[model samples]
Structures are given as C-alpha cells and as structure tokens.
Target: MSQILKLFNFIRIFWFLILPLVCFGQEKEKPRLELGGAFRVNYVYSSWKEEQKTKGGEFGYDMFRINAKASYKNIFLNAEYRLYSEAFGGGFLKQGWVGYKFNKKDELHAGLVYVPFGIKQYNSHNWFFNITYYVGLEDDHDMGLKYLHTGDKWDYAFAFLKNAEELNFGGGVENSSSRYSYDVVGRNKETNQFNGKVVRKLGQHIKHRIGFSGQYGSLYNIDTNKNGHHYALGLHYEMNWKNWNLKTEAITVSHAPENAPGESNKIIKMGAYGTPYEVASDFNMYTAAVSKKISVNWGPISQIEVYNDFGYMQKKEKEFTDSFQNVTGLLVTAGQVYTYIDYAAGYNHSWLGGNFVDDFSAGNPDAKWEARFNINIGYYF
Candidate 1:
C-alpha cells in the first residue's frame, strides 16, 4: 500500500530526530568532564661563534613541548606542541583553541589563538613557572579571535588577526629558491590584525600590565611590483617582589614605501628605497629575575635562580651594510628546581636574529658572543 506508507514515514522521521536529544539529556545537571596534560624533556649544550650549534652539545635534545587541555561545561579545549629539533616535526605553530565560558570566568575564543598581546611570562612558555633569561619580550603569535576576562584581581584580553606565514630568514641560494622564503620581517599579507590587553593586581605582591599591538597590510613585491604601508607599536611592563622579578618592553616600527626607487628620486618615493628595504625599525627589551627558596634534606628541595636579558635592535636599513644600528643581548640564568630535577645555565649575550636562535644568520651576523646550557626532566598529569 505504498510500501506500508514508506515505512510509516521512516519511523516518523526517526522519532522526530531523537526527541530533542532525549529531552536535552534529561534536563542536564552539570559536571561535564575534564582532562589535562603536560610534558617537557630537554638537555642542551651550546655554542655560537655567532649562531647555530645547540642541536646537542656534549649532549642533545634541545627542547620538547607537549600540552593538552579539555573541558565541558561552558565548552573549552586547548593544545600545544613544540620541539626545536628532529627537523621541525612537532613544530606545529604552537597553539590551537576553542572556547566558551561566559560565566565561570568570561571567555569567548576561537581557533589558532593567542594575540593576548604580551607580558604573561614573555608571551607564555606553556606556563610551569617559566624563567629562562626572561628574554625581554616579542614572541608575537597570530591567527586569532579572542575575548577573555578573568578576575580575582582583574585580567583582560581582546584580539583579531591573521598575519602569519613568514619565517624564512633569507639564506641565499637565490634566497633559497624563493617561494616567499618564509617572509617574516613585519609581515602583512593583506591588512586585518588587531590587539588589546589589560591586567592588574596590586597590593598583595604587585602586578600591573598594559598593552597595544599592531599590523596592517600592503607590501607587494611579486617580483618587484612594489607597494607599501606597514606599521607597528607596542609597550609592556611587569613587576613582582619577594624573590624579585622585573620586565620592560617597547617597540616601534614603520615602513612606508609607495613607489620607492631612487638615486636621487627620479620617480618612486616613499621613505626612499634603502637596500633590502626596511626603512625603519626599533625594538627594546629588558628583564630581571631573582629567586630564593631552599629547604633541604631532600624534601622541599631546591630553587636557586638568577636571570638577566636585554635585547635591542634599531635599524633604518638602506643597506648601509644592511643597517644594524644597535643590536644587543645579555642573558644569564642559573637554575635548580627540584621535586625531580630541572637544571639550567645560560650565558647568552646577544646578536643573532628573530626566532631567538636556531641560527639562520638573521640578525645579519655582525655582533658576537654566545652561550647556552640547558637541562630538564618533567612530569605532571
């Protein structure tokens, strides 16, 4: 009779689509689920007649990073994976996110995150009480959408971005057969990036933070089709005492090239072409650290650390030999934190560029004096 009326209309549309998920799982009650993870294994020996030789020194395993987080209530999830060796395998760009929580702690995030804009342990090192020469700051991470607010002492974050895809530090084999060679030097693929921040906690161990960030598009060089418009501005500060900690950060960058070309301007002009082109640059950083906590007999273990870091770069390149006006770095770290081992030693005095140090000769190689030593063993679940 019409095949039993099409099987009774497919069982009444599958019971009207599971009847509102069984009455919303019996009118839900709470306590969704939770899980967490963390792991890091490192041991490094250093060398840098100018850069690149920490693959292993008298030993190996420069670094290792892994992280995970999950929650269900107002919805949440997070990820982190990092490693500096083995040919960049787990170097998956460092983060991933999904969030929602407008109550238990105000959060509303969305994928490929972290534009929180600075000063959370120098842009965060997956937080486990980080202290590695406290390298001033500038670990800009992008690809974002965020809004986070937390309280007890006030915290805030705001973001909007997409200016990734650059990190090739030019090595010349024709700039390594150019494919944009990882393009990073105030990268801006097309405009569209934003940032915000605020943090306060004073009178209980002091804390204060401020932020503003930037990036704007237009920088085309599709084989010299030339174009312009670039920008950046930043400020940051942090302080703590009891064992002591202090920080400072500053940045100002500009590149306004539009029709730039000249031997005395016959046509193109916009900050007038200067070699590899980066008409202006400025970056400054400062750091300080002091630690104390020692109670022995193999119980409360150890905590002995010392720190220092200062990195500065100010250039106005027009190829005055690739302009590197002020480049500096001075780092010193001493560590011994134990429940089960975490030893460190660093003697880094700067002059190598960008991703800190993996050595592709980015700081353009003119300054010298390098040192690094590391050790780690971690466990927490």
Candidate 2:
C-alpha cells in the first residue's frame, strides 16, 4: 500500500511539471536570422624600440571576423569566427553557443561561452584591456553549460566548464595552441570548472551596479597525472551618470598546480596566440575605467568618446614584481566606420615591452616603462 501511494504521488507531481514545459515547447514562433562582420586595421608606434620611432612605426592588416545569431521559438544560436595574420594566431572561433530561453528572464547556454566573471562584457576602455587579461581571468571563455537569470534590477549566471576549446580533435596535443582568449594549456590543462556571478542595480538617473563573481577549477598535470586546483573571487562595480560611464573591479586569483619534480609551484604555464608563457600562480588584480561621450558634428563623424583605463597586478609572493598598465584614448564614430586612437603605457608588462613570459611571472623588478601609440580603424556591416 505504501509503495503504491509513493508512486502515485510522484506521477502526480511530474505530470504537473512536465505538461506545461511540453505545451510551451509546442507553441509556434517565427524564426529569425542575423549575420554581421567587420574588417579592421591598425597602426602602431612602439616607444621602447628605436627603429619604430625612427621609421614612423608600421601600419598593417589586423583581422576580419564574422558573427551570426539565429532564433527559432525558444531555441537560439550565436557564433563568431575571426581570421588573424599567421603571426598572430591564424583563424579561430571566438564564440559559438546554442541557447534555450526558459522564459523572458531565464535562459540556458551551452558550448564555448564566456565565463561569468568580473564585469559582464568588458572591464577596460582601451584596446590594450586590463592586467587581468594577460593572467587568463578577464574576458575568458571555455567549453561549458551556463544558466542565466536576468531580472529587472538583478542578473545571475552559473556555469560548469569542462575545459578550454581545442583547435583539433587529436585527443592528444597540438604543436600550436594558437587561439583567442587565454587558457590553461601546455603541460597543464584546466577541467571541471564552476563559475558564478550576481549583480544588483541601484539608483535611477545615477545608476550603479554592484556585483560579485567566483570560480573554482581543477588543474590537470599531464605529466604528474594528478590534479591541482584554482579559484578566484572578484568584486565588480559599474556606474552610469548621464553621459559618463565607469567600470571597476578587484580580483584575487590562486592556482596550485601539481608540477613534476624540480618544477616550481609559484608559477604555471598558460597558452594562446600560438605561444605558451608562465604566469604567477597567485596575485591580486585591480582595474578602473571611466569614459564620457561627446556629441559632435565633424563631417561624417557625429560622436566621440574620451576615456582612460588602468590595470594593476600585485603578486602575493612579495618576491615577484608588480605590473601596471594605463591607456587614454578617444573613440570616434562615423556611420559604419569606427576609430580608436590611444596611447598606452606600462611597467613590467608583457605586450607593452617587458619580457613576455617573465613579465607576468616573476618579472624584472628593475624593468623600465614602455609606451605605445596606436590607432585602430574598423568597418562594420
């Protein structure tokens, strides 16, 4: 009698739960399609190099990219691919995700999707981005499934990422890990990661968003045949006051890798753009950016934005040197043509002039400052 009653109660509860979802899935809706892409070029002047200053810098082709989005009823898709010079990383998929909308405020996403951390879209105002970018925490993505809930004044996302996107299905390793976005690669790999983010908005005219993010993952050592761990916590803030915008965030990251004998655990290897480099295993990062839009009528140009972005990384080891980056720039919008002109400066930074792998790792305590003047122009369609 007791077993029969339990089975009857379970069936009754499932009937009510499954019937509505089955009915909603049957509703007919029109399909939608959208496709877009962009072409961009860059001119850069490296102040740290003597020849660049003497020859007036170099102008070169940057990249071309394609983006697509489609929807059929509650099911939707988004994908993007980019082609860069061979010296950069060749061709790669920036993002490709399939989603299902549970309702107006809830959705589910799967595949290579952005990790919900720090700020939503970005945490920097310049082309150089922030310090967290180099260490593989900001604007990072992975193969994962995500659940999102967006309320009027609150947004929440949770994800479980299996690993980084692999360029080939060799089931082993590739000679080149060239791809977009930083990830744990080389002798070590990332797996079984969980991420969560929550944000709440306040104020009306002077709006502010306070958010928090958390992550935990496993670091698999191919050689050691053991697993280490990594985790990060971040606090994010954003403000919008009329024409001004602000974004700021502080984060602490720790990675403990099971390295082989004679290997140092203070740093781990990360790879992207066909290159692998060492990054400090533990550090605190901070970033802040502010921008203001000015309406103007200058020929085809209608509006321009003036902004500054700053990033800093402080290694917890105390023996390791710190890194700093700052960029001030203007973005001009003229119909389909958008342009960015900026000057970026940094100390103990990789892209800015300090040694690539060493700068973000132990770093050179006596490293001098390096600067770059850059202009990027792109056409969107």
Candidate 3:
C-alpha cells in the first residue's frame, strides 16, 4: 500500500510540474512536437542449441518502439517506449525525461534518464553491448536529476539518481524486473547514486575524447534494514580519424551488500528483463573496439560500418572465473533502414550461453566457448 501511494504521489507531482509547460502559459515561438519510432526484427543461431545446426536458426520479431520529442523553447520532453514479446519480458519504457536548458552549454534533466557513466551513447558497436552493460555499469538509466555542461574543449556531467525505473509500468508478473536497462532489483534496491564524469576533446581534424567517470551508490537491503554500498571508477577514450574510429575503456566496480544473516555477501543480486542474477562483489573490466566506415552507392544504401568489439571481466576472488566476449559485426545504413550482422562469442558470459545467475559471480571455470550469429534489421521513421 505504501509503495502504491508513493507511486501515485510521484505521478501527481510530475503532472503538476508539467501541466504549466503543457499549457504554454508564457511566451513561446510555437511548440514543436516530433514523433518517431522503429520496427526491428532479429535472427539468431546459437552454438549451444541442439537444433541450431539442423534447423539453421530462428527468426522473429525483435521489438517495436515509439519515441516522442517535444520542445517549447528551452523546455523539452523526450521519451521512448518499447514493446517486446511475453517470453522476452513484455513491454517497458526505455527512457523518459524532461529537460530545461539554461544556455547553449548548460542543461538540466529530470525524471527517468540515462546514467552518465563510462562511454557516451554506447560502449560497444554491436547490439549485445559489453560485459559492463550486463552488470548494470554501462548504458544504465535511473530516476533522478542530471546536470550537464558542454564547453568548447571540456564536457562535464553530474547526476544524482534516486533509484532505478519504478516497477509500475505495463503488465507483468509481480516484482518482475521486465524493463529496459539493467538495474538492481528484488530485495536489494539501488538508491541515492551519485555520478560524475568529465571529458576533454582534443584536436580538430583527428578528434579525440578522453574521459573519466566515478559513481557511488547505496543498496537498501529490505531484510537487513541497512544500506550497502556500490562504487565504480572508469577510464574511457575515443578517437575518430577520417572514417576510422577507436574506443577503449577500463572500469573497476565493487558491490558490498548488507545481506541477511547467513546469506552470501560475496555476490549481490542484480536483474533486468524478468530475470535475477548474482554478480561478483568486486571485479575489473576492460574493452576495446575499432570500426571503419565505407561509402557505397548501392540503391538506398549509402554507408557500411564494420567493427570488432572485445571485452573481458576479471573477478577479484581467486575461486571465481573470469568472463570474455567478442563481437565482429557490420552495420548497413539505408534510407530509414538499418541492418546489423554480427558473430559474437563468449566464455562464462551472462548472455552468451553461460549460466544466467552465476555467470558473473562464481562462473564455471571449464565453460566451453559458445558462439551466436545474429542479424538485426530495423526501419525507422
């Protein structure tokens, strides 16, 4: 009942705050609203599947999404909602936020927004992302306020995320984490996370972005009635020269959960998309990727991007096994159409055929290498 009340109150406050903006009470140069979305499908062939070699693979609908962006002068609203099949955890909002721009260089965002950590936009070229993503360290989103500043050579971002996305959207199993972006869920919930990141851009023709990110957050263990701590530090680098791009990053994360008596503290529970998993308490991760773009005049297609991404995760405990993932992929871009073809392989990875819950914690040391061939095609409007 209390949680329900809190949700109601949050909705009320949000509506009240946004009501004035909707009315456009003040002077405005006409509000602009833009609606766009994507329809995507996927094909996959996994090595671990018994019928993969014979049946070839499976092809099915991947997702359908709707994105909205409306701006009235300095204030704007951005949101994206996605729908997936029931087996894949059903529907959820990817991200939604309201923003006020103070100036060309400064802005503030409120509501459920992306966490400013590690690399901007994405840490990998392929769809599966990197190991840090599965662990909720990359491309994560939460509910709170964020401040950003973009200078000529230096860019800064600071955010205070109160919590992850609420579990009160769409229809799903009770307490099910069927949503976008990996987050701490179940009994141990994430709260009051503080993130700071800074980047320096160097050179004009051969562009470069060097950045560092750090975050500290709390985990509220419902059973313990106390707060645990989670901290991470990241070093990132990206360089673009002509049609070639390079990205590299290193991150170290530690999670100390205040668990119930006799419960294991070596691993903490984190989850997403209707599944809960255990992650190692302390680990170091690293990734490197390179891509090249080539122009083609084949009908509607205009460009092709080929890339390879590699990531590795090493646990602090000697008994725990490490994780590795590598993806070689190419992206084809046409008018309002995009296609991605990838060959991804992993050993002891959460999404690449390893045990879902224990892959990031005490993973099997003798895990065999598994490969997945995937193709994702989408149309945007």
Candidate 4:
C-alpha cells in the first residue's frame, strides 16, 4: 500500500513537532487573550409627554451602547449593540455551550443560549428596566439546542428552537394571524417558527422553568391564509439567605389560526381614492416578575429591588381591523444598587385601550399614553 502510505506521513510529521512543543512546555499560562467589551454614549432630551402616541413616540438622539463578551475553557461569548435616539434599536445576545465534562455531570449547548428562563433577574438589561418594561415573555433569545444536567440537589434543561420570534409592548410583532410593523419586523426576511423548552430543579433554593415554541411560516401580503403558529408557558422562583434575595416569574403567549378571509384587504390608489380597512391579527400574552435583596454597608453590600409586568391581548373572530386590547404595567423601582458595578436611573410606562373579554371590543379609538426614560450602566464578568 505504497509502503504503508509512506510510513503514515512520516509519523504525521514527527507528531506535529514534539507534540505541540511538549504541550506548550507543560501548559500553565493563560490570560493574554483577554479583550472584554462595553461602551455607552448617552445624551438624550426626552419628549412624547404621555397622551397618545403608542410605541415609543418621538425622542431625539442620544443613546449609543456596545458590549462584547468572551470566555475560555468550556466556552462562552456575548454581544449586544444598540444605537437609538430617534433611530430606534435592538440588542441582546448571551451565549454559552460549555460541554466536555461529560463525566462529573453533564453539559451541551448549541447557538444562542440562556436556559433558566427566569428568576435570575439582576442585570436584566440594567435592573429590569428600572421597574417596568414588560418582563417574562421577553427573555429566551432564539436559535437553540440545549441539554444540561447536574446533581447535588437538581438542575436540568432541554431546548430546541429553529426560528422563534418575539417582541412586543407597543413594539408590535404580533403572531397567530399577523401584526407586524416596525418596518415589517425589520425587513421581513421570512422563516416564521419552530420552538421548544424545558427546565426543572428542586431543593437548595427552588427552581422550575418551562417553554414552548412554534412557527410554520408564510406572510407577505395577505393571500387568504399563508400558515401560522405560536405558543409558550412558564413559571420560576428563587430564594437566598445571608444578605437576602427572592425572585418570581410567569409567562404565556398563544397564536395560530389565520387563513386570511373577509379581512385584511391591502390598500392603495392615490390616483382615485379608496384605502382604509385592514386590521386582522389575533394576540395573547401574560408576563410577571419580582425581586428583592437588602443589607447595606459598602464592599459586599446590598439594597436591591421589586418588579412587575402584565399583558393581556384579544382580537380574534376574524380580527376586525386589529387593535382591540393591550394593557401593560411595570412599576416599582429603587435607585442606585450594585452587584457588579452598574449605576442606574429609570422609568417605563405603557397603556393602550380596547377589550370586551374574548368578545373583541369595538375596533379603535383611545390610543395614547406611552412613556420611557432610562439611564443605565453595567460592568460584569
């Protein structure tokens, strides 16, 4: 066989020259690849004095944020970038898939992960939006594939998401029949849904989390039904003692039932005159949050938080001209607290009308009261 393939490529080039420099001279020097990331630029002069102007009405420029993250050994990476000030923005991505210690316990991850689902709210984007920003149904970043198990007390996880999507609180992106606008959910590229989730833990504190995801696809310009689906449910809790800490969470969302019929009739005709009648989209969402911690001093100090969030939606029965009911409330925040160095300031408000309880209220009329004010900073590793 050609002399045994030339003696196996001459012993694989002498075993890559002394086995990688003798394993880097018996390894014991790591920490040169340290290049963390975080940058912020704020300077805003607010407006939209609550009265009426739904989603983030109008506020000038003065918000720039950039964050970078990395870790070695098992594996970790993070990235969040934002730039808003009349331009609007979106950013949030925390990843980890550390697996290899398949003996001591267990681990495995694939793309964009954060499994505990809730009740670990500390720096949830600068202390839960300083007391209001529709919590819960707003975590879980997509692109999934996870599995982790640890024993001593308990810890487990299971997730599988292909193309899940979510974003609300006046910032429309509805599902179950279509309600996308924010530039068509950011330039509609397409790939609707497919989701999954599962978490369980007991003793030594407390834990339990759940999740479900689904997305069929089809959405371009109303064609009497182009496919749809969406669903989720959750529950979580935590406890601690010494300094003191507590947490809570809940979530639910449903969608799937729309084939386009007797509603949504695209409009146009500037040359003549005839356009006004298109709003068929169903909705449903419920969220929650709670936090606590106090024991002040200086170095290892405390004096933490308490939070809230709620969302109820309805507009089925062939969704007659969308926008029926939406109630969002998140109030309760204290100033200045720390854990990993993060200065703070906050305010977020939301309230829109319409609802007759599964009867789908009378359509539209009463749209206003949207507020937001945030000053945040953080440094954690």
* Cα-based lDDT for every prediction: 0.41, 0.85, 0.86, 0.34
Highest lDDT against the true fold, candidate: 3
TM-scores for every candidate against the unseen true structure: 0.26, 0.91, 0.92, 0.25
Top TM-score prediction, candidate number? 3
Candidate 4 per-residue lDDT, tens place, 1-381, comes to 443343345335434543543455456633112234333333222234343234443323332333443334444444333333222222222332323334567766666545334333331323323221222233434445666666655555555644323333232233211111111122121233333333344444444333232223333323332444434454544444443334443444343434345542221101000111122233343333343444445454334433333323333444333331111222222233222222222211221222212122234434333333433333332
Off by over 4 Å in 1: 1-31, 37-44, 48-70, 77-112, 116-214, 217-316, 319-380
Model 4 clash pairs are 52-368, 61-85, 193-215, 194-215, 195-213, 224-259, 225-259, 279-322, 324-354
Candidate 3 runs further than 4 Å off: 1-28, 168-175
Residue 14, model 1: lDDT of: 36
Candidate 2, lDDT over the whole model: 0.85
For residues 1-381, could you state the per-residue lDDT of candidate 2 as single tens digits? 443353345445534544554465565644566768899999999988889999999999998887767676788878777777777776777788989999999999999999999887878777777777777777887899999999989999999999888665554463246768888777678889999999998999999999999999998887788899999999999999999999999999999999889989999878777677888899999999999999999999999999999999999988999989999999999999999999999999878987787788899988999999999999998
TM-score of 3: 0.92
Report lDDT (Cα) of residue 67, candidate 3. 77
Whole-model alpha-carbon lDDT for candidate 1: 0.41
Ranking by lDDT: 3, 2, 1, 4
Compared with the true structure, what per-residue lDDT tens digits does model 1 show for residues 148-233? Answer: 78777778777775544333434221111111112233222322456666766556656554444444545443333555555555
